[model samples]
Target: MFIRAESKALNEAIAPALCAVSAKNTVAVLECLYLNAEDGKLTVIGYDNSKGMKTSCDADIIESGCILVKGMKFAGIIKMMPQGEITIATDERNNVSISSGKTKFEIAGMSGDIFPALPELVSEKGITLSQAFLKKMISQTIFSYAQTDIKPVYMGILFEFKDSELRVCSCDGYRISFCKAPFSSGESLTERFIVPGKTLTELQKLLKDDDTPVNIELTRRHIVFSFNGLFFFSRLMEGEFLDYENSFQKVFKTYITVDISELIDSIERAGLIIDDKMKTAIKFIIYGDVLQIKTATETGKIDEEITAEVEGEDLTIGFNHRYIIEALKGAQISGDDKIVMSLNTPFSGMVITPVDHEDYKYMILPVRM
Candidate 1:
């Protein structure tokens, strides 16, 4: 399409949408960014078939047209160009030209007719939540999403909306993270969706402010996130998430409250030594009023004890150091000056809560060292 826009504004729109571009694209059109111009504004869209993103910026339309240009090359050009007006146009021969000031670049574009049709947002089941609350929920749980594809369903985060709250959960079998926030009334009559972790992270990055509210719509196959002139859509994973609630049954035989930073530092240092081990488990040894974290490996052994208000039965439990570190790093601990961890056995899920946040909770499944 023929349109003129500022370089920085164009880059801002292109960067987030480009996250959907697939490196191993099976279709040639999936590798390009689709541009559509209508009335006075131009819209940029990108999708790798499974996930799609659409974003728009104010533009001066000279001619109305649509075309698909190579995503990487277009993004690279936009990012390198200085702050100035950029003019983009496509000819009858499908040649695309991008010009800014004294420089101009031309690249061949494909017909937009071949691009996959975007899924419509079915508003039948949806909810409205503050961007601030949703952002916190995503950041805290997304790290637990599985990185492996052995179990395809585990690779994404689960969104369960029922009654009046949205619960976001993720687990790779070894660790599970759960967070929930209240939803507005008259939302989500009946529905649940599992969104891929990659998609959620992109949405999290695109949201620049916390004051804005995000509109989330869910269909049987796709979930749509809309805010601030941007629309993000992702294909939902198609399997049942594990029965997460049932796994919480194991009571805490021993619970302790310790400094959040101190606990994080202790585990991180222990990980330096545990890095050589295959399991990377850190042993938590608790006595009367203190707790000690230790891990051993070929390099050396790390041992650190932190003061805590320990009660109940004194016990030791093994946990995957990676999971604990991930949860603690983003914790919002307050009031009590300590992080609370409850555990029954290394095989059961361990619950970590910030003393500051009564509504927020983090769960991690421990590993045998």
Candidate 2:
């Protein structure tokens, strides 16, 4: 393969695709980026069997061919090259040469024929939404996904489309993050799938916060996301996601509305004295329009109070500090925005929702103190 392209354009195409390339893989080709130069463009692909990303950029294709080069090294070389044009070529021996104005380097490459083939990108079942909306939905829920592999099913975020609404949910046994928005596909589509958290994390980085639409396609076993000349696909997790709709409590004995920033600051202050190694729980005493936050450890103790609009029966509850902080932060609340907290018992999960809308809900299991 021989191609000439601007360094900036090449970096833009190669950088995002590297997210799918594993640093070390048992399959040698999985660690390499497949470069196919043809038809006046250079297409770069990185696949690690479970998920993959492909992107293309305009290039001067001297010869229509393909080769595989080490993903990390090639990306590094392109990024560090001079600001002008870059030329990449390969010989019969599979030796790859990358050069800029006054510098050049040679590296070993493998035939592109050995790289794993990506899944088919077309499907009849799919939805199109603005990149900003999808990015926000993923950011709000991804925090609750399981970080461990003990429950493989919980390690992904669930995407459910029904009744012209799309709901995204994630749970990690201790807490649940849920967000939904109205979506009209005109086809009355009802579909559900689970995408691995790792895939969404990388996708989030590439997603631009704009009005550009992202086309999502779902096959029997894979999900594809296409936007701005980039194709990202990941294998869908097998098995049923938790029935999250029914898990949230509908009744509450205590309700409190407080400023989002004030509450977050109080909890973060309490977190300062609590050590992760001790597994400490922050105690909340809510009564008479005042919420008292308290926590103590060998390091120190904190007692802080914040004003709130309290209703129903007053209650004292305990929760893992980190869980509460993460849940609040994930809400994407801003200044002057208030959140309502509802609780039934010390053991029941605390449900949080914005004071103005019900579009997002976060539930955290209370710690037994």
Candidate 3:
């Protein structure tokens, strides 16, 4: 393919597509980015066996052709090149040429035909939602996936849609992230899909603007997201995720309403005394309108208390530091914003929600300290 594109335009388009380049590939071509230039447009595609991303850019197409080149290296050279148009061309020998200003380089490339075909579902009708909401949903949930592959299915974030409400959920056995956002669907839809945590991480990068709408298409085996002329495809996880609705049924023995920043600040300051070398749990002692946070080890200790609105019962509980830390982060609460936490016992999960916001909930499992 012979095409000319501005350095900024080409670099921006190529960056997101590189997210799908297989980290480990047995086939040489799988590591290459597929480039197709035709009719004044250039299309870039990267695909691992499981996930893929494709993006297009306006280019001066001198000829209609296709080629495959190392995706990362090409992107690097384009990014480093001076701010000017870069010309890319492929020779009959399957070698690729890149030139900008006074610099030029040739890289070996392969036939684009050898690459696995990208999904072709352009004609299918898909749901549309605000890019900002999609980005927020992924950010709030993706972090809660279990780090281990012990429960492979638990390593994904679930997208459940029914009754015209879309819910995004993630849980690692110990803590759960739940966020619900309403959207107008293009058609009547009731479905559930588990998307791997890594896919959403990359999607966060691609879906940059909140004002734009994102088009999403789902198939039996894959889900496709399109926004800003970029297409992202991911293979759906192959198992049924836990029915998360049942997890929130446990009633609270005690519920506390606390300022988001005050609670987060106290937990963070208390965490400083925790020993990095051992498993540590933060203790919460609640009574009246005061909440005490304390943790200790051979090195030192921290005992701190902050104001809270307490009801039902005075309770004491212990939990791993990470659970609460991440839960606070996922809640995305700000100054003056309040959070309500429900606790049954040290053994039951503690569900935390932003006051007045029923659609968002973050749960952390307590520990025995």
Candidate 4:
């Protein structure tokens, strides 16, 4: 393919497409990226058997053709090249010649005709949601996703769309984390599916903090995301997601409202005494108008108190301070906002929600003292 494009723009297209490149394969056609230069546009495509990505860059196409080059090698060459225009051409022998202002290089490439083809998405309705919202939802919940390979279903984040509200939930058995974003109006996009945590993570990296709409299309076996001239495709897992909504149906006997930063600071200090080996717990001595965080070890101990607005009965509870800290960070709480904590007993999971909103919910199971 004879395509002359600016090095900066070329790299931008290559980088995103590499998200789907098979890093596991040391050899084979899967190691290369498909480059098609035609109709005044240069499109780069990469696909593993499961996921794929395609990105387009504006280029000066002198001759319309297609070729495949080692994905990482080609990306590395472009990455180090100067910022000026770069010309790439593939001859009949499948040798690729790439050069910019002063430097030039030639490399072996594969014929694009033999590359694996991507699946054709069935004609279905597409849903549009903001990039900023999707990014926030994933960040707030993905941390709690299951890491083990035993239960493959738990390794994914659930995308639940029901009654117009989208809730993303992740759990590692010990805790459940979730966030919600409203879909203002759409052409009846309602369904539930699990997207692998790793896939969500890669997609999150590409999402900017803007309000740019991300178009989503899904079928029984595959899901596609398109935005800003970039296309992402991922295979859907075959299983039903956990019933996350049922976890929030419990009755709460105690509710405490405290400053978000103050509780976070106290939890941070309490976590200092505990490490992975030590396995310490932060005991919460809840009583009239005050919440105390206490952590003790053979080496040392810590105790911190902060004023809280408590209602219902007073009780002492214990929890892993790390969960509270992570949840607080994910919730993105501010000074003006208060944290609402709900509890039934020391054995039940403590629910944490930010003031005046159901946008996010964090749950932490108590650690027995």
RMSD value for candidate 1: 2.4
The prediction achieving the highest TM-score against the true structure is: 2
lDDT for 193 (candidate 3): 85
- Put down candidate 2 lDDT per residue, 1-369, tens digits, no spaces: 888999999999999999999888787888899999999999999998889999999999999899999999889889998888999999998999999878999999998888777877668687789999999899889888999988999999999997789999999999999988888896888888999998999899989999999999998999999998899999999878989999999999999998888989999888888888988999999989999998988999899899999999989999999898887877643212888899998989999888887788999999988
Q: Order of candidates by lDDT, top first?
A: 2, 4, 3, 1
Local distance difference test values of all predictions, in order: 0.80, 0.90, 0.84, 0.86
Report the error of model 4 at residue 118, Å.
Answer: 1.7
Steric overlap count per candidate: 1, 0, 0, 0
Question: Where in model 1 is the C-alpha error above 4 Å?
Answer: 23-27, 187-190, 333-336
* Model 4 vs. true fold: TM: 0.89
Residue lDDT tens for model 4, 140-199 = 897888899677888888988878889899988878998887764546667788888878
Estimate TM-scores for all models. Answer: 0.91, 0.96, 0.92, 0.89
How big is the RMSD of model 3?
2.2
Is candidate 1 or 4 superior in lDDT? 4
Instruction: Order the candidates by TM-score, highest first.
Output: 2, 3, 1, 4
Predict model 3's lDDT versus the native. Answer: 0.84
The clash number for model 2 is 0
Off by over 4 Å in 2: 25-27, 333-336
lDDT of 3 by residue, 221-327 (tens): 78899888888999889787878888874788889998877888888887787775686889999999999998887768889889889988888899888678777
Model 1 poorest ten-residue lDDT run: 329-338
Pairs clashing in candidate 1?
Answer: 334-356
Best candidate according to lDDT: 2
